[model samples]
Target: MAKQFENNMEECFSTSKGVFYLKSLSLEDNGSVSQVIKKRIEAINDENQESEEGDAFFVADIGVIKRQHKKWKTVLPRIEPFYAVKSNPEPLVLKTLANLGTGFDCASKDEIQRILDLSVDPSRIVFAQTTKQISFLRHAQKHKVKLMTFDNEDELYKIKHKYPGAELLLRIQTDKIKGSVNFGMKFGASLDSTKPLLQLAKALGLNIIGVSYHAGCLIAEPRAYRDALEHARSVFDEAKELGYDMNLVDVGGGFPATMEAGITFEVIASRLSQAVDDMFPKDVRVIAEPGRFYSTNAFTLCTQIISRRVVSTEGDSDPTFMYYINDGIFGSFRTLDFGYIHPVLKVLRKNQEIQDDWSGEKVYTSSIWGPTCSPDDFVAKETKLPKLESGDWIIWEKMGSYTSPASSEFNGIPKPKVYFTET
Candidate 1:
């Protein structure tokens, strides 16, 4: 599986550094995943030494992305993945997924254009956003992107008049399923509105193709998908009664990138697979808009601590330490607005042996802040970590989704640079 990904890495370049390297670094050369990560980080640090301005960067493992695709193929073989372009649409990430024969779930005109620029077939793209600008709709139509999602009557009219040939999918509400960021509140239609929406589509002579629902983002419970699938089955029946061919069932993304305790991907996949098998027949095409699952685990964020503040506390408790990193909420930690917390941090010491025993090490209750001016530009609110100082480096895993795409240049903090490797 690793070899399959290695052969496709034609060009490996880091845009920020303006440097080029061969794509021949395979897993075998490094011995293990940890070794590969350490070697890559060392190389990145070597490059960073020449620049005066400290910049956070991402290490993207194409091998991890390929392994994820392979895992999906093994677990839920029937459901094809439409990689959500909104989540960490890094060029190399998209190119890798495209090369692996995965489809894309685009939301905006720019996203559609990005996928098209990759030379991906229009048939492999789904305009997955529920609300869209009129110009973006025309762009999709001009580009021949037929599959799109809608819920309300206004969207139906827009699609009917502008992109009449579009294959519409009714996005039903699935908020009952709790997640880190639930789309049911912002997107999906209520259960009561599903039938009328389908009727309205039929009245407008719109091509209603199927049903879709997003259980939530970073979902932990398998029962959530089971519940959403049941509603999808009901909507499929409604579409059929309205003389619409409801063949595609888009069980939208909520798959876990990193499972919480007592939860596993296999558990969710098994429950979802059983639900689909019991509800839909073999002819029905099942697809998912998985963004984080394929992304989060594939990238590691390397950030440098630029400054720190120590606040003395009362009496016996330890003082609170605040460490400021080069990147912040405005940069790769953009998803902090959605209540996503940074993972447990790993301290990478320069020219020092990796510490195995931290039992006697001085630990502090610390808060990591981004380099933004805003008081709320925090990455981790409260976590215990070994005392860190400026110039020291910290690493976070599972950072590829809902991070870079949502990043901004607010306060002049640029988005992190990304480097790709097949190993």
Candidate 2:
């Protein structure tokens, strides 16, 4: 067991960028995530005995990430996952994914540099941003990172002038779907523009390798992939007519990471794999840029309540409560503003005892706020929970996506510390 743990830890740290250091505990004998949270809270209490400081922190389960990757392989064996670094770029997460032999989808020079710093080969990265700065293009050229994407004529001209040798994928717009974040409003060229773009690339003596499209984030319909794949096939045929042998089709990301999402990863994978098998040949490479699929459920965030207030409405007999936590919208809960994720809060502890549930107990309607002064920095506008006092810990699961990387130290409140465990 010790040898296995050491080997796993070594694999996780092998590609470290040295941006941060982490100490991970290996849980054995059926240890639970709640147990890990309890242990860390106790350690924090012991260390801050005099200050009585109970700050926010994260407990990341690295083992969960490994399981997610394994599941991805089992379900979609043909397609490769190029993790969207913008999701959670935690060093441990990156290192683990890198060691798992997954590719990376980078949007900026910094993201590319970070992956390169991990000693990752430039071949494993795709500069997926449709609109990119010239400086970013130059950086990619300097690093010998050749694969990239472009959707507009200006981008083609920029690439022709800057990185002429870079391989390109033409990003096409997908049909607008409801109940998902529409990415076509911002990126992707229309179908009418696809042939023109291919013609333009050919005229400019540029290499157009394939097609790419994003169905949208949190896609509700699995058939969305089928529609997008059909559109991509048309682009591939157009490229073929333009004397370009496109051998790649990037089915861009919108995969659900949690069970609460509109669709399951398994359903999406099943539909997507069938589409790919139908549309493209075996020689064509297929890849995806998944942001939330791997990180969402792997992290659990814990925040400490610093203060509370009782409010009595004019007509209501019961009083509503307001609780302020150490972290907020400007910090870890930044995704709330964008409606990307809604975390379900669990009480880790209240009055020094573990709180599994509030069953049979009187619950109060409460509002949760962050430490920032911004009135909009609310975690939950209305929630029902047993009365909680200051110093109590609240756990938010499935918080690994779009949280830390987008967070800021607004109002000078420190970011949460992260602890790692493998169960």
Candidate 3:
């Protein structure tokens, strides 16, 4: 399972499959891409993989995966990544996730078709559609993907008419999170509606084995999860009342991934673990769809400065500069407009430390604009960097998950490469 890579100006780039730009490196004189990466790793003395757990890439950090993934924990924590393929469906990413032994949570036929091309097993995928295309239902059935979701009767009927022998789960509608930006607006059928959805499934002889919900992304309160438990309890209670048995409870993907602030994993995990002990049904199998949590910090995107624009003000004003980069919204940092910050660090320039208070200081401001021809190419609307020149590399760490999976070459820009690490 070795991969081929590409080099731009001698720096090494590692995409999941072939060469990528984000993992780009700056090469020494007369160096090739592969050599550049090896040299960089050797210099850092962090390139060696000791144990599977300590390595950056490995299958699930769970045991068997280590052997299969070799030192990559054979794919890097095959946590059933249920990869939000819509985020960035580059074959490299899918193959990487698949190699890790993860199942997918596909939403559309095109997405399913794409994964199918790569030979992903139908059983390793869950067609999680709240709204599904009727034709795709038969494809899902024909393909042997046994699991799916719904919050309404229409979805139930569509699946019933197309593939009635399917297994199903009712999408539990989570309440509005106080300050949620993305997930609060869409999805869900209330506690009452869930009853009928479940009943509808029973009526059609659809195997209703589970119940699911999304607390929405970046939920602030541990209580939000705690509160959702109550909703789930009510749903589970209804199933029992209707003489139905549910074997699974899917706490769908709302495990927050860096919306600047939210409950930490240690805290949330502790709380949920306690709740499961006290409340979760004795016979239920617990499954979580965590698209962001595991992969959020797994990788980073490195973009070089293609150009720098300096903005200067008058009347004792400080000099502000913008470093337009080769990657932008197309690279999936568009959430910045909604205050999503991925924590930027300068990769090549080691001496400059990001300042805590540069308000009064002469701050050199710059914007890392993506390579799109559109005026909206800026990824970070206002970026503060040291006096940097063109070609200096900027590292946006923990960007592996949503970044590439959601990127687009709007201006025909070639997607950047992805490099994995066991360091």
Candidate 4:
């Protein structure tokens, strides 16, 4: 691929101070993922930085990097952030957040070890896994990791036998969002069963510290937090009655980002803030573990247009085309689950100044597929994009969340090419 047009706005674009998105490819002017990636990589090369061994990058310095550091006024003071490691698990994302003083919510021994290797203190990590693998339990206890959660009696027994003195938190079940993914039924103990578990922990001499719960992912209503907050308040009152001093409240992550519509962070934050102020005790250390909210919209996915195939829409009014990219379900795009219909952009032929209408207005029912041989290797079922041939790169914006860590090495299809982009 060659540089298609000379940029007259390159100077202004390059001088942008903080993290920016959607400033490239003035043709559609819709900000495609691949164009931003190309420009970002070019910038990195221009600065004489050696491209790392991997063809993939999250571009933290430009996007999440700016949000993590140097933008306290905009990011911090809004919400207390605890990064969910299962989302990306990459060292760059973990290390960057840790350096910014962000705490982590680790689910497994590996995730916990990775954080600790970065010198993230045990106190800064919540061994949030609801399940108690004996090895993970011992590791956390040995590391003096102060907090872990459980919703059942069997896990309490494991803790009692392996690490009795380990501090613990009871995961309370609450219905945060009605239609949201049911985090409660999956991992949490219902309100009725919790009292008996508290007794079991006491009998085993396990230390009970605090309580926590997750309202599910992509929470769209601010009232969702309020619903959970009210439940937490009741649970706290019960714990206090049980003669246990609870000082921590883990509001598990479900805070929605600027998704297509429905709910916004500011709205969710307002509700969460009010819930804490109203119900959460002042001394109760309030913290949230948000995975997608922080990193999702902050980054994009750039893939090469490897092949173009025609779609047969025999008598149908709408036409369809299939643009095969190098990324697949392994690319982490499937985690969106909530219909990720974001825009796509095309970077045209290199070495040419603006070709008059080289880009057409015609929209095609584009289904972007991955290069895997499996039938299930598709990324998007029916996406719309400008028709294109091989060599043109297509970009998917707001793909910073579960995309990378969720990538599978099935069939040995390499991960999609990655790059960072900002204004």
Question: Least lDDT summed over 10 consecutive residues: which range in candidate 2?
Answer: 1-10
lDDT (0 to 1) per candidate: 0.80, 0.84, 0.60, 0.66
Q: Between prediction 2 and prediction 3, which has the larger TM-score?
A: 2
Distance from true location, Cα of 157 in model 2, Å: 0.8
TM-score of each candidate structure, all chains considered together: 0.89, 0.92, 0.75, 0.80
Q: Give candidate 2 regions above 4 Å deviation.
A: 1-31, 47-53, 351-356
Residue pairs with backbone overlap in model 4: 2-350, 3-351, 33-395, 34-395, 332-403
Residue 176, candidate 4: alpha-carbon lDDT? 44
lDDT of 3 by residue, 1-423 (tens): 123223333333344344433222222312432233333333333455333211111111112122323422222222223656654465545555665666677888877877776677887777787888877887887788778888888888887788887777788877655535445357778766777777777888777777777776666777777777678777878888887887767776755443435566556656665676567755666666656654555555556666777767787466776776666786556555554335455344433432334456444666667777778777766766557676555656556456655666677665565443322
Choose the strongest candidate by TM-score.
2
For model 4 the TM-score comes to: 0.80
The weakest ten consecutive residues by lDDT in model 3 span 53-62
Scored by Cα lDDT, where does model 4 land?
0.66
Residue 241's C-alpha lDDT in candidate 2?
A: 85
For TM-score, candidate 1 versus 4, the one ahead is 1
lDDT, candidate 1, at 241: 79
Q: Give the winner by lDDT.
A: 2
